[model samples]
Target chain A: MEKIVLKNVCKIFGDHPQKALKLLKEGKDKDEIQAKTGSVVGVNQASFEVKEGEIVVVMGLSGSGKSTLVRCINRLFEPTSGEIFVDGQDVTKLSREELRQFRQQKFGMVFQNFALFPHRTVIHNVEFGLEIQKSDLSVRREKAEKALELVGLKGWGEKFPSELSGGMQQRVGLARALAMDPDILLMDEAFSALDPLIRRDMQDELIEMQQSMRKTIVFISHDLDEALKLGDRIVLMKDGAVVQIGTPEDILMNPSNEYVAKFVEEVDITKVLTAETIMKKSQDVAYLTSDGPRAAMRKMKNNAIASLFVLDKQNKLHGVVFADEVAKLIEKGEKSLESAIHRDAAAVSPDTPASELFAVMQSISHPVAVVDENNKLKGIIVKGLLMAAIAERGGNI
Target chain B: MSFELPRLPLGDGIEAVLDFLVHNLAFATKAFSAVADQGIRLMETAMMAVHPIIMIFILTALVFYLTRQRGVTIFTFLGMGLIWNLGLWSATVSTLSLVLVATLIAISIGIPIGIFCALNGYAYKIVRPILDFMQTLPAFVYLIPAIPFFGLGRVAAIFATVIFSMPPAIRFTTLGIKQVPKELVECADAFGADRWQKLFKIQLPLAKTTIMGGVNQTIMLALSMVVIAAMIGARGLGGEVWRAIQRLQPGAGFEAGIGIVIVAIILDRVLQKLSKS
Candidate 1:
């Protein structure tokens, strides 16, 4: 199910938005149209959909309207034109009261600066939304307590926002939002105010939480790595227009335009690329159920490999056999390839990030066998292929 | 040739307007003065009903208990004792009555108008300059216009005192509410708080200390009007001072003035403590 859908949404910020929007639809660029109409284009005809239980990150440089786009989703900034549908209801048509109620019920937002009410105690801040929903005092308190605990602030309820550190205050903000249990979580640069290490921890924690809760979250970020780390799909924006929308790999490997290519220029590819993107198919590789060592020897020679990984018919990894071991086995008239197979074999999974492959490759001189969860040998990661992948992406720096 | 610019008849215009209102709405004026007369008599009689000696001890104990400042309590005790021993106790009580009534009424009127102006842009635009004019006007000038509405008496004095004192109350409340952080206001809106909920729960509470400052100013400004108010048939330390001035008795005038100062100081300290707490 699509949780959110925006069709030709445009937010023109000025007194005469209708006039500016008309010029925008005439194919005029933001600068040109803005100069002519005296109106700044906040978001220009942007369109995208967020799937249920998926994290969609809208990412860009400063002034890219990434922040504005997220605010538009919750109607914090009403779009000058276009339709926004959430759970099949067009939010643009909602009246002022209904819109406010919609925001309270369906959307929970975390801000860039941690916008916690400084005057309120941490628990009161968490209970604010619950209280607005008219949950009685005791119930609100219990829910607030649990929400704070979920954010790892278990017992600091009585303290004010001013008493907590920047990161903890943001956690309180997250807790405040979470207390309401809204269907969609809107995080607007939620971790950007924190120190770098704390920011990374917050990103990881958010990812971990998403794994269990499976919330549909719309996150805005200017940092590419953060977008890649937490987003299932990214909507890359530029000058209030969506330049591209794709998965992390799709964005990194096949940037659709020069602008998108420039955006990916400084991306740390090893951190983004996975084993699946680089692994080679293993259809003709050696297996334990196959004939004698001669068959393995012929397969190794044909593939120009000194060794071959052996797998059972069920596709589970049996072991590996080097050309020397197979040749020795053949001289001894060994019939089954099983006896020649080395019990211990270096292996990696298809999802193993490319950055970690170098150390694993350094630990073992042989190509790494990529295995699935059932110990099935799905593919192999050669050291040379990993190096070539790094070299190819290195120019982006 | 010297060509002179024509002077505006702004003063005449106001005087004419006041005359018209005094003529047309004398009934409202009488009704208001009656209420003020009743309120002042009630407060003064209550204070007088409590013996002066008892009032002094109560005030000192209150200062000590609320503020917990030994120096302030000692100062208050000595000050009130000096005034009571100087035989100006009744005058001091009457002065306290007039100022307290005026300040109480000023706060009641100011806070709502300030809140109204804060929430409505047009109201603020209209009210801001009115407040500035009220504040900048010389205290003595209020008496001239005050006499027409509430004819000569303590009622007229309180009418003038409220006018002179109300500006800070309005200005400060507006400023205090404005000073509430926009981030907090946004959070309040996001949580589905209606206007009243946001005002009472979020904005008003956050702006409490600041609004108290306005209350402080209102009380102080009203106290400043004691002597000025006495000129308009108002009784109190101002009346005592006025009588002494008329009789050419500097010694009595100075004592009455000191008595007024004592009341002002006690009121200021107590109010300051209440707000801080």
Candidate 2:
């Protein structure tokens, strides 16, 4: 089920939103509506869904509606029109008190500038949400300590925000959100304030955090690399509307528009497109010993493939056996096909980049077997597919 | 060429209102005046009970404690000695009592009004001109109405002092709170802090330095109005200064004037120390 669904959410910034909304419904452009009613469209019928435990990154430039879209989900901006459902509850239609309660109980937000309270110590900052809920002191302290520890800030709880470095302050911010244990996390450019090195560190930390916490997160970012690295699905916005929505590979391979194309034009597609995505998953394989040469011949005949992957009884990859090798083994009446298993087959892990695998692919004529760490065959990456995937890397991040 | 415009009768309208208040709101006015009288008398008696030498020592100690400046502390003790040598210690006590009571009352009312102005733009618009008039009106003009309503006494003196001293307290408080960073206020809102929580937790603490500045100004203005205050029969160093002026004794007037300056400087220092964040 979708954890959050934003259906045709529209937000206009001006005194006469109703009049501006009329023009918006009439399909007037943002500039035309703005000129007529003196209103700026923040989000124009932006719609998307975030599945449970998915990290959906909203990406855009400075004037894009990405920030406005995420804020509308929590009713921070009060979208002019449209419905927002969070975990099946109509968050858009919630009363003010209900919205406040929803924000407190369900949403944990982190910001770009690390909005830690200056007056509060690190522990107290982390405990702020619990304090708002009027949780008892002991419980707040316990949860705050755990959260600080989770963010690698266990011993620094007594220090105020001013005493901490910029990176540490942002860690405190992350801990503050984590301390709440909320179902949804809304991060609005949460690491943009840090330096590039620290930014990468924070991204890695978030990647690690989302693994265990698995909170449905809607992260807003302007950096394409950050979005591509973190998001399961990216919603790229431009001019207050959704420009495209797709996985990193989908965007890199087939950009929906010229705008999406330009956005991905500078990105290194190899870093974004993993070996698992590049490999063909439909290839057939034979057991190393249990499925003999006869079985391999029949499988190759049915699939009309020249070669097959030989696997052991445990499904561990033994080697690749060609159709001719299997047919010769069957003609010799050898029930055991151990001699047919060629152990010199080239293998690449699923996480190995297509760039790194191209050197191996160049020396071999057969498909490169993409395997897991356990030597089990996952899929195959053909030379033609690798060349095409690499050729499709014209876009930027 | 001179052009003649009809007189506006604004003064007459104010006089009529005051007249109506005196006649119709006699009981309310009496109750308010009585409460103020009791408070001033209480502070006066408390100051009087201590010996002049003991008071000087105590003032020196308080200065030392608050400011932690040995130079300022010694100067405070010497200043109190100068007032005592002038034979104006009793009158100094009375002046201290009046100024203290007036400041307490003014700040009690002014701070809330300042907060109101900061929070509500409509209230600020209404009170902006009122505060301007209160701060700018000549000290003598306060007595014209003071004589008719409160009749010449410490109550009238204190009433005038309150009106004179209140504007700075209100203005500084409003400025201080309004100056609190918008981002911090937004952060507070994002955290779901209620209005009162936001005021106390975020706004008031950040505005501390400036608000104390307002209090310090109010105290100075109250002391500056001392001589005018004594014209309404309020006893103090101001009374001594006024009496010496009436009798044309320059020597006595100068000594009393010196005493007022000493008290003003010492009080200003103590308040200044308290204001630091």
Candidate 3:
């Protein structure tokens, strides 16, 4: 089910919005409309849909109207024309009172600058949305406390926002939004104001939280890497119009225009290309329960490989067996492959980024093993394949 | 003779408007002034009934409680003691009472108008020029119409003082609320705060120091009006100063003026301390 859908939404800011809107409809672009009618187009016919429990990132530079586009969904900017549907309800048609109620009940928003109330204690700031919703004091306090705990600020609730560091302040901001327990979260550059290291930590924390919470999120960001890391599907916007909306891989592989290609040109490839994307499927593996050292050695010789991965009968990875070790085992007449297997091979989960694999690959000459969560052998990542995979994905090695 | 420009009846027009207000609104103004007069008198009597030494001790205690500043507390104690020593205690009390009532009225009326102006552009558009006129017009000019409506007493003086002092409170309040960061306002709106909630919870709390600064200015402006207010029989330090000037007692005039300065400093300091916390 779609959580949010914006159709032909437009937001023109000026004394005469209708005039600019009319000019926009007549095929005038943002600058032309602005010049012709003295009205700035904030968002121009933006259309997109966010599915349930998905993080749809709206990515753009400043003045691209990504922020405006997000705000319009909640009726903050009030779309000049067109429909906004959230859970099948027309948000644009809601009256002011209805809209307020809808926002109070459904949407939780987080801001870039950590707009925590300075006068309020961390818990009180978190409880702000509940207070507006007219929840009983005790009930709101409980929820606020739980939210503070969720954001890893469990006992810092009594402290004022000013008392905390920048990172902690934004944690309080996230707590404030989470305390509302709303279905959809609209995060407008929520971590952009933090230091780079703290920003990455926040991104990881948000991803961790999303795994369990699964709230549909529309995250707006100026940073391409952030969008790629956090978004299930990324919406690329330019000059108040959505240029492209697709999965991160789809975007990197097939940019719809020169602008998008330029926008994503400088992204760090190692961070994006995962071990699963970089690893090749294993051709052959010796079963520890069935195959002896001689069979493993023959398979390695036939495949023109120095080593072979040994798995148990259930296809769970045992370890890698080198040709020389197998030959030694064969000379000693060892029946079980376990005697020949080197159990200390480095293994990475399928989702591990290629950047982490570089360190693992550097310390060892053997291909790195990619395994499933159950330790089932999935594939192997060779040193040459890692660079080749990244280059194949349109990244400079 | 050279060509003559047509004479504008601006002053005459103002006089006519004042005349109309005096005729139509006298009963209402009189009723309001009577209530205000009673309140001011009650406060004055309560303060005057206390011994000067006792009042000094109480005020020093208050200053200490508000500021937690040893220096300010000592200043309050010594300042009040000096006023008592100079036989200016009663005059100081009277001036303080007049200022208190005038500031109360100014803030009560001014703050709402300021908030209204902040929220409504049309109202601000109408009120802005009027505020300018009220602020820039000579403080003494208010006394002319004030006498007809409030009838020459502390009430009339208070009327003039409120008019003189109220502009900063309104201007600063509007500025403070307007200066509340756009992001904070958006945050409040995002959280589903209504107009009243947003104003009270977000805008007002954020704008507090600025608004308090305005109130401080209002109090100081009220104190500045005391001598001018004394011209209409509103007795206080101003009345003492007026008497000394007439009798050519420059020493007495300076003592009363210094007394006013002491009161202004104490009030300003206390307010600043309070706002910071």
Per-candidate count of clashing residue pairs (backbone under 3 Å): 1, 9, 0
Q: Give model 2's DockQ, 2 decimals.
A: 0.32
State the iRMSD of every prediction, in order shown.
1.5, 1.9, 0.6
Rank order (by lDDT, best first): 3, 1, 2
**A29-139: candidate 2 lDDT, tens digit per residue:** 999998899999999999899999999999999989998898898877899999999989999888877777788888888888887878778998899888877799999
- TM-score for predicted model 1 compared with the true structure: 0.91
Total clashing pairs in model 3: 0
- Name the DockQ score for candidate 1: 0.56
Error of 2 at A265 (Å): 1.7
Best by DockQ: 3
Q: How accurate locally, in lDDT, is each candidate?
A: 0.88, 0.87, 0.91
Stretches of candidate 3 above 4 Å error? B1-7, B247-252
What local lDDT does model 2 show for residue A155? 96
- Rank candidates by TM-score, best first: 3, 1, 2
Q: Please write out the lDDT profile of model 1 over residues B1-277, one tens digit for every residue.
A: 9999999999899989999998999887888777778888898899899888899899889889999999899999999999989988888888888988888888999999989888888999999888889888888999988887877888889999998999888888888999898877877776667788889888999889999989998999999896778999887889999999899999999988888877888888888988886
Model 1, range A154-193, lDDT digits (tens) per residue?
Answer: 9999999999999999999999999999889999899999
